[model samples]
Target chain A: MSTIVVFVEHAAGAPRRGSQEALGAASALGATVVAVLCGNGADAAAAQCGKFGAARAVVLDATAWSPDSAAIGVAALVRAEKASAFLASATSSGRDVAPRVAALLDCTLFSDCTALRKDGEKLVVTRPWLAGKLDATLRSSAPVLCATLRRNMFAVKETGGTAAVSKGPALGPGKAVLEKIEARAGGKLDVAEAPVVVSGGRGLKEAPNFALLEDLASAFGNAAVGASRAVVDAGWRPHSEQVGQTGKTVSPQLYIAVGISGAIQHLAGMKTSKVIVAINKDPEAPIFKLADYGIVGDAFEIVPALAQAVRKIKAQG
Target chain B: MKIIACIKRVPTTDLQPRVAADGKSLDAAGVQYMTSFYDEIAVEEAIKQKEKHGGEVTVLTIGSAEASKEVREALAKGADKGVILVDNAWGGRDPLATAKTLAGKITELGADLVLLGRVGTDRDNASVGPMLAALLGWACVTDVVGLELGDGKGTARREADAGTETYAFALPAVITCQKDLNEPRYAGLKGIMAAKKKPLEESPCPPATSQVEIEKLALPPARKAGRIVGEGAAAVPALIDALRNEAKIL
Candidate 1:
């Protein structure tokens, strides 16, 4: 079987959900899976990779978060194992380093792929082009197929197996060095990873009016607040929360667009959501055309009522 | 300081892209084209760096001769010159090949710093910048929202899903710009006239073998049409019922 190497990132001694999903994807390909990890708690995380179908795990002794250095270690591991494929999640750091690793290996990278499959001896991936407006299925002719899988798209398998764990190469000091990091306040959920997203647009009227969105998001408990390009450009919301072609493409289980008229750009971002709900004053808004359910009226009156209803349901359950 | 800004011409954001007859490419006919959104930021940042550090800013791109429009626009915004590595099939080439092509040009141009958008709005690969840095053996930081350049060194802050990460890197580095880094300035009429006379060079890109090929291209399936469950605040109950009982996702 061909060997596939997966780069795993972790938190609190466990693999991040996206990393687990990457391992799961590699294992599902019916290949020999080797996982490579770095940073503190990598050993603990490496030990748990077997459940996700990794046959072996290599922990690189890199404590610092340096993208170039990480790529070096991953490239070395790929060479050592003669891996035919490499996989990582499409997180910020993953996107940062995977391309460098591919360059080191003299290969091309497929970013934020939504699907992967084996075709005879070739690996094929499905990814969004034109900001999710077009889905392109691709095959890599490079020696190793390098790809970053989109989060929440693949399943995490439990094989009840154990991976043989070992140490890999030590990292060298890279030219770019990580200094310090400031975590987002309140440990707020990221819109891309949230189960439910409550997004607002100009209909909110002002920055402070987003309190209604926050209240609704709080009611959901796991929901994140998102914004349209207009709001983000107007400085009413952070760019991170913008959901559109130039922003994040989110596929949460539930997506709620309030006061958004559903520009084509905004629709491209959240159109893949499992269930969409749009609330706007304009009855003829384009967003309602794609929404699974819609409420027409003043967002000021509708949002508070929806929040109360959501809280009531949560309380009963 | 010598600065270079790499850009890509892409379909405008408002476009509803359609698949071509080949079933593996976009229907380019009648599609409006413009500089990728973040690339505008890249061009702006390059001019700013030149103003602060006193150097020439070269705007580089890989596209058809028609891309001169984008290059001239950058020049109008204070870029010193423009270079187009003319390639009609740039969209078909994978990130590595694109990086190698750029590395060849950047090596020839010689720069202290390079800027690119965090992600190309077209393919959304977000790879060429770091890949080019690796090919050139230089440091790279992606999704940079804030930056401060010093003599032969710099500090950058990048946005991440987890938090904001700060990095210290030396000169001769690649920094991929994120939105909010700066508000890109518009070119005035005088600058536009001046841009018409600025040096804009065009050459064929050195051929590199692409490792990826598109097997198929198609639009995602249309969402099933939905209904207005109810109207106003009174609709909340029915919406809740649908979510709890039907979607089972509440």
Candidate 2:
């Protein structure tokens, strides 16, 4: 019988949402889902994985697996278990680790898979190619198949079933060590993790004028700040903050684009957001067609008002 | 020092794309193509590194005949030469196949250092670089924003979700350039003319075996229309009420 191995990703002790999504997908894939936690004190991750429907949770106690050699340890676990399928989240860590694990197993992997199914005896994986412009179905010939699920693509569910927990022996001494981590300047939430994102474009006119976007985002409280390719190319904001086909692909619950005419490349990244709001003076802007809510007016006047209104509501609460 | 930079010619994602009737490929009727934005940065970084370390830069690409134009563009920008890995049979292969083909060519060329874009503009998979490194059994540093190379060793600063991570690796390593790594340069008229004379080599390789295949392609569903509350700061009151009572976000 083939078994499914879901690699658990966590920070400190809290589990990442993408990891839960991977477990959910694994459960649907018809294999006995096994969760593998590689770092020290992984009981929390194991429990969370069980709550999310893993049939069994395996904790591999290895300090070397702590941020630095996590990939090597994951490769080792995948090899030792002889897992037929290995699942990961498509975050930075997953992206870095999945390919290496696949290489170690001498197998092929599909990244950013949105869905999966069994086609006869082979597993057919569905993934967005060409910046989400094309959906491709992939089948692997190797005995071990690997995939990284996109964030928020699958819903997380709790099966309320008890999971069998097991402990595994450590691999060996790791080659890399965890050094210090330095944070970025922005205290705002990351664009990828934010439920709501308010982004600005060149239409905001100048750098300081971005205050309108800041005010609006602050009003939302849970929102993050983002920018278009043009604004970032013009050096109005850092490249890290850019969102487009070339930059970060985000699918926040709500995305508000300000003073922006949606270009195809720009739309590709955020079109998947649950609710879209476009604020632009041009009624015919491409953004209007995609927005769930659109206001055809000057952003300078609309944004400030929106901010104040949001503030008032929050204060009332 | 010798550097090999791998590039791809992708459709300029700025335009809307149409799916063919087969529902598995792009129509490609009027869409324009260009060197991927990240690959441009890779080429520029290679040129800058060559300028600093006194080495030769060779730009390599795997694509159809039209992709040679992108190689010429790289040569025009300052590369010493250009090489095209032409495989008509491998045009529609997956990322792993593409990486294997490129790795074979890179090995044949005897590259000391390999540079690639963090990810291509079209696919956004971010897999080929690491896969190539694994195939070659070479050290790799990905999403690099800063780099320093000397004495057959290198150090790189890579961007992560939490922060920057620094890594040190020996020579014959693979480094994927990110957007913040360097500013790409434009090809001047002189460089464009000089590019015509640069050595352009064409090599054909056998098609790589692919384990993944595409099933279908379709457009994303459209969002429903949303109602506007009012106008200006005065309208803010009603908007707040809507968000609280209607949307429940607040």
Candidate 3:
């Protein structure tokens, strides 16, 4: 079997959901899966990788947050294991490190791949091009197929297996070092990872009006507030919340677009969402064309009412 | 300080793409082209650094001669010069190959700092900047939103899933720009005329064999047409009912 090395990220002492999903994806292809972990608490995290489908785990002794340094460790692990493929979650840090690892191995790196499969002797990946407008299936001819897997796209399975854990390599010093981290306000969900996204546009009128969207998101309990490019460009919301071609592409279980006219750019970001709901005053809004369910009315009145209903539903539970 | 900003020419976001006859590439019909969105920020940052540190800003790209339009646009925005590593098959080159070519040019230029958009709008690989840095044996920070430089070193902040991460790196490093880093300035008529007088050099990129092969390219599946739940606030109950019962997403 071909050996597949997966770079697993962890929080505290447990593996992150996205990293487990990446491990699940690698094992599903019938490859010999090896998991690699680094940084603080990585030793404990390595022992847990087997439950997520990794057959073996290597713990790298590195405590600092330096992508280049981490890349050096991952590249060394790949060569040590003679892996045919390397995979990581397509998170901010994953994207930062995987490219350097690929470069070290003299291979091309594929970012944010949504699908992976083994075709005979080839490993094929499916990824979005041009900001989700085009889906391209690709095959690699490099020594190792390096890719970052998109979150929530793959399954996380538990096999009740135990991995043979061992110490691997130590990270080299990085020229660029992480000095500090300023965490976003605690308990707030990121739009990209949240299951539900409540996005607003110019129809909100002003910045303060976003409180209505926030209340709705709060009612959902698991939802994150997002923004259209119009609002983000106008400084009504941070660029981090913008959902469009030029912004982040979000694929949520439920995506609600309020006051958005559904520009091609905005639609491309959320159209892949499982369920789309649009609330707009304009009856002819383009967003309605893509919404699985749409409410044609003033968002000012409908959003508050929706929030109340959601709260009631949660209360009943 | 010597600064270089790398950019790519891509189709505007307004385009509704159609699959070409080859079924593996853009149709290239009526597609309008512009500098990739975040690259304007890269150019702006480069010029700002040049102004603050007294250096020459060089805009670089690897594409067909047509990419000169974007290079000249950067020059008009205060870059001292431009270089285009002419590659007719630029769009088809894999990310590592593209980074290798750019790394060669950056080394030859002996730049102190290099900036690039987090990802090219075309393939959206988001790999070239860090890959280039690795190939050149330099430090790299990706998706940078804020930055400050002094004493031959820089501090940058990037937005991550959990929070904002601050990184400190020395000179001769690579930084990939994100939006909100700065508002890119528009070129005035005088600036445009001056840009015509600026140097724009073009050279043939070394032929590189791509490691990744596109098997197929197609538009994403369209969402099924949907129904209007109801009008106004009265629609809330029905929407909730559908979410709970039909979609089971509540």
Q: Tell how far residue B152 is off in model 3, in angstroms.
A: 2.2
Report residue A141 deviation for candidate 3 (angstroms). 1.1
What docking grade does candidate 1 earn?
Answer: high
Badly placed stretches (over 4 Å) of model 2 are A39-44, A58-69, A117-122, A137-142, A160-179, A312-317, B225-230, B234-250
Question: By summed lDDT, which 10 consecutive residues of candidate 3 chain B come out lowest?
Answer: B159-168
Model 2 docking tier (incorrect/acceptable/medium/high): acceptable
Provide the lowest-lDDT 10-residue window in model 1 chain A. A37-46
lDDT of 2 by residue, A51-112 (tens): 88798888878754333245566777777777889999887677877776776666677888
Whole-model Cα lDDT per candidate? 0.92, 0.79, 0.91
Q: What's the chain B TM-score of candidate 3?
A: 0.98
Clashing pairs in 3: none
Docking class of 3: high
lDDT of 2 at A292: 66
Please give, for residues B1-250, the per-residue lDDT of candidate 1 as tens digits. Answer: 9999999999998889889898988898889999999999999999898888898999999999999999999999999999999988777788899999999999999999999998888898999999999999999999999989988999999999888999999989999999979899999999999999999999998776788888999998889988888889999899888888987898
